[model samples]
Target chain A: MPLRLACQAMGTRFELVLAGQSEDQLRAVGELALEEIQIAHGRWNAFANDSVLSHLARCAGGPPVTLDPETFDLLQTCVRVAKQSRGFFNPLLGPLLHKLGLRDETKLDPAEDLGTLLDVRGLVLDPKGHSAQLTRPGMQLDLGAIAKGAALDLAARVLVDEGVTCALLHGGTSTALALDPPPGKDAWQVVIGPEKHAPRAHLAHSALSVSAANSRRGSLPRGDHSHILDPHRSRGTRHLQAAAVVAPSAATADAWSTALVAGCLPSDPPQGLGLLTQTTSDSWLLAPGRPSCFHIEPCTTTTPPLTAAPF
Target chain B: MHDNHSSPDRRTVLMAGAGGAATQILPDFLAARPHLGADLRVGLVGVGRQGRAILAELGKFDEVTLVAYCDTDERRLGSAARRAKGAKGYATQDAMLAAHPNLDALLIATPTHLHRAPCEGGLAAAKHIYCESPLAHSIEDCRAITAAAASAGKVFQTGYQGRANPVYKLARSFVRSGAIRDVLSMSAQSNQKNSWRTPASDPVRDKALNWRLDPEVTLGLAGELGAQQFDVLHWFTSKYPVRVEASGGILAWHDGREVADTVQARLTYKDGSQLSWNATLGNTYNGTQEILMGTMGTVRLAWSHGWLFKESDAPTQGWEVYANRQQFHNDEGITLIADATKLASQGKLKKGVGLPHPGLYYGLETFFQSITQEKDVVCSAEEGLRATAIAIKVQTALTTGQAQDISEADLASK
Candidate 1:
């Protein structure tokens, strides 16, 4: 039998043996999900256009974000993650990230050699709706840093509640979320890597992945571009070919691992992540002393670089 | 050695060729597909009557291999021994065992009374078995056979051939799929009025011929025809019959027979599914020619003139019908679903539309296949116990005036 949706208080996407009332309920849930995505997308793009946050010394006017309730909820989550990462994973990077070609507004034209120096403290959030005024314009707010992972964790929770016990949700394949316990099998597993879209890559273990070749890279349908703009170089994150992050969720692993490489953390692995990056010799090297905050482990399995499906 | 990670396989003899003739059915069965992946091979016990016919029938399959053949009658054993190919023939079953040490399955078709011994022998040899039903001489004997199979980890599939009829399979499929909604109850008839056999002259032939009348050996009337009918009914309704009410008496026979000429039974299952059936082998004209009824549909899987009834008006003054054996096979005949479809094709598509043809031989096939795979067969010892328990009660019902309650533990010693 195929996986059936477990309709519960969380949501409704039940797969029935006999097509009964369940068909209509799932369609409604799908609609709600799409609307949520549009709202989140609009909010992120609005932050990119606001000029106040970046020009802190030059201007005093900025735009306020106006999106639906879900988007509002998403921004609130950003405030939470920013607080958790201690501003190190700042969502208020609108000014500095934009200057480095990271904002969704401008068609990014990358300059060579971007590296860390992006200031995290310059960003701020207003507790009220549509009212957080950036000190000046050109301050691009990029929630791209952690919102994708945060949303995945949230959506997985909701989807599981809605009777979707087993699913592979790709919020853009670079970030994937799998929420299934390995019932009648070895263990719950997933695959993460660049070129994950290639037929060759398959999950045999629990995994998560991210790469610099996202859509920001070039003219490919879905290539991982260096979305992480090194504030020092005023350009996209560079060098160290592709990074393969294996954690429980692609959203968190992919986003944070990208942050790690873009910030120019030392060649020796940091304590908080399971980092595997391609070396000049083409072999992948891993980081040391993992962070106790999340579950991540050294992986020996092969994976292709992640690419987007033909939209 | 005690440390374990996998589920324990509690096996029962599923299908072991009793002697050599099982070879007849397999070659034709496996001939079309030379491989069963890794299924068990079958052996036949007796090469007389049913065993002889089965030997030739199995000859049509390539998947069948002759293992060993047994017969108390040395004359028949020698002839069958020559025809059985590489399989060895023994005057007694013990000699055959000394030869095929690796033998995995046995099919017992000697006689209704002789079914238990070979079953016990096969069990001791660690072989899965598919035995002809009634299963044994007494409700007690059948119980003993079932217990031995359970203890030896051998699968036992009682030969209840009519359960293999695709119409019953079709009806079960429909009901399980909930096409008919919660079933209120069900009723079945097996009025197979006499004319089942011919008269015999020789005393020994007469003894075999009048198996129904012989109190000395024959399981009597209920065992002869009632056994097949009850087993099929038990399988069609997943519930073992909780009680049976029956009345039968001997009205006529060619020679003042002790066996009843007419017998009928009414069975009530746990869910209150009522089943009524009659077997009067003396009369042939009254035959409905293979009929089945269900909540969602009704079907006839007879060899000729089959019919399927779906949510509709009552069957006509005469039954709705399809001609030809094509009703049993599909356009390709490669699988069972297509074969059932050819019968069910006329009706609207419903859930569980196709019947489960675990097969008359397919069950036997599964028996041996499980032995080969070292897995247990589908039919459990308890199922054999359940069917036998109902049969004894039905026999008692035919004679005595009350209903009997048989529990799982009651069947254990039985």
Candidate 2:
């Protein structure tokens, strides 16, 4: 029997489905996973003054501040992904987002130029010393695109370490991590957008993340102003309708999904990754090795809407 | 000291006494005079599930001694006795009271229907009483127990643990301090997915164990769970509800249970402020929380956590630097209320897997402190009766398909 628990964490709904354990044991493990997610939120949240991200943003261009191992590793991952995407996935765009009134209030240095402040290369990390410094005068870090995914990944690791074999973890219904499949089943069956005519993916030991820019705007006239911004262009991207990525980790899938939809990276994802892109005219799916793993039904007249993201 | 020579039948004497101001002044006057005791001897009735928890909390105080344990279930009585070490076990409250006549206080954790007898008995024995909430199953019983506690001149604490929770206290202070401005309305919810029945080894005990499923014995969701939340509303607004309209049904778990699994109620106060409360056993979406909306801001409170959402034009309280760290629904998280700063300073908060059950622990500590210091209890019998009256009225409104008005005359009626 499978047990499911739902809780609110990281400003979104999180669901944990576990098998091969009693309800009591599953509940205990679920609580542990939620606690871990809260700790991650406390560390990586850009809005909180007590968070390490805020601390780094405030102390930019000053003495280096030593960070905890968890935060240091997260910063390292953010820098690595930003470099991999050619500054398209930069975390130093917090000031720009704040100026646009897209996020909570943030303090930015008044004297520094916007270009220097939004430069991702200005962040200096020393892994050995467990410390980081913002080399520029006005740099700020925002992990809005990747923190939820990272929290989900950490929660999944908690379940696995607790001896849970078949489990599925989701953060806000957009980012999901599937552990080993249920007994006698090939994989965890997940339905992507459009319930009636949508594509269904069989996920086995993988993670899926979806990014939709127009989800929040509904039928408003300002729907064209996308929330997903291209850090390289320093503006919102409105070309793509939706994008989904399947990778070994939720953080990777989250980053790529944002990158693909923002037009920072090409629609054709790198090798060993699955991509699903939806545009105004048509939708496409590209699976490198197992192309037939997903089954998509023909579009019906009343196509169901895609799952909305909380970005 | 209480005048024990007045009458053994305190209920009769109290019913005949003046109803106006004496009843209000007597408890306060008696509470001001110390009982002159260094050690407190306590007796517990109904040492079952919730009883065991109270017993453990009581054991934490060195000045408090568990003198007797009483329960109808022999197995539970024996277990409680073992936990209390030197405490004696009995099969009835009468037996325990007779054996321990000098008990300073009696903590009653019995079921709703069984509360009146032990509470009145403890009062007649000149013992301070601490009774669990939803004071009794009927309005008459609640009136009788409260009247007895009043005339007996003994400390009577009701277990609405929210009154003892620091987070709730802090949130209440924030709302009342004019930080949130004129209160407009409030809403509360408690959602949980559970069977609400404990397993039993015997067939007969199985039905008895799940007494909450019986409509006659239980007050259903409103009485059992909503009592604490209603108390919180009163504490925050300083006003009892004037009228209540409610609706409920057994929406799920159609397993021959008469009580409703889901309930929604709205209460109207004299000041035109309204409060809405809903509870369901079928879903656990947001778990449990209470939200208070005002002219300037809003306060969302849970048992273990709380957050304040201020309006954009409202004046900043200088705590935004701390609150802005966590965000939910565009609201900043207020860390001062929920975090363990006090416990950390006292070296009591631990970095570990489990959190402390602060509500019950602090509630029990308050009960003991009232006994030792001759002070008024945080949740007195008057507070308990008012909240219970509202909850009972809500239940009545649900069943009668009409709104019910709460009156002081009805609360004071025997």
lDDT of 2 by residue, A201-221 (tens): 677788888787666564322
Native A-B contact fraction in model 1: 0.00
Error of 2 at A210 (Å): 34
TM-score, chain B, predicted structure 1: 0.72
TM-score of chain A of each: 0.58, 0.88
Give me candidate 2's TM-score against the actual structure. 0.53
The residue pairs in collision within model 2 are A48-B325
The residue-by-residue lDDT of candidate 1 on B40-97, one tens digit each, is 4667898765675455445423556777888876656875764566678887777788
Query: Could you tell me how far off, in angstroms, the CA of residue B45 lies in candidate 2 after the best superposition?
Result: 0.9
- What is the per-residue lDDT of model 2 for residues B1-414, given as tens digits with 9 covering 90 to 100? 111112122122122222212322222111212233468999988886678667645533556778898998876776565456668999998898888888999999998878999999999999988899888877888888889988999889989887876667667767777767899999999888655654344668756666777777778788888988998878887878889999988886665567788999999988888999999888887878888998888888877656678788889644353232347765675443333332232222221001133357667767877888875588888778878888889888887889998887766635
- lDDT by residue for model 1 (A73-176), tens: 55555454444444434454555554444333332224511122234333344444322333333333556634555445545544443454444444544554
Interface DockQ of candidate 1: 0.00
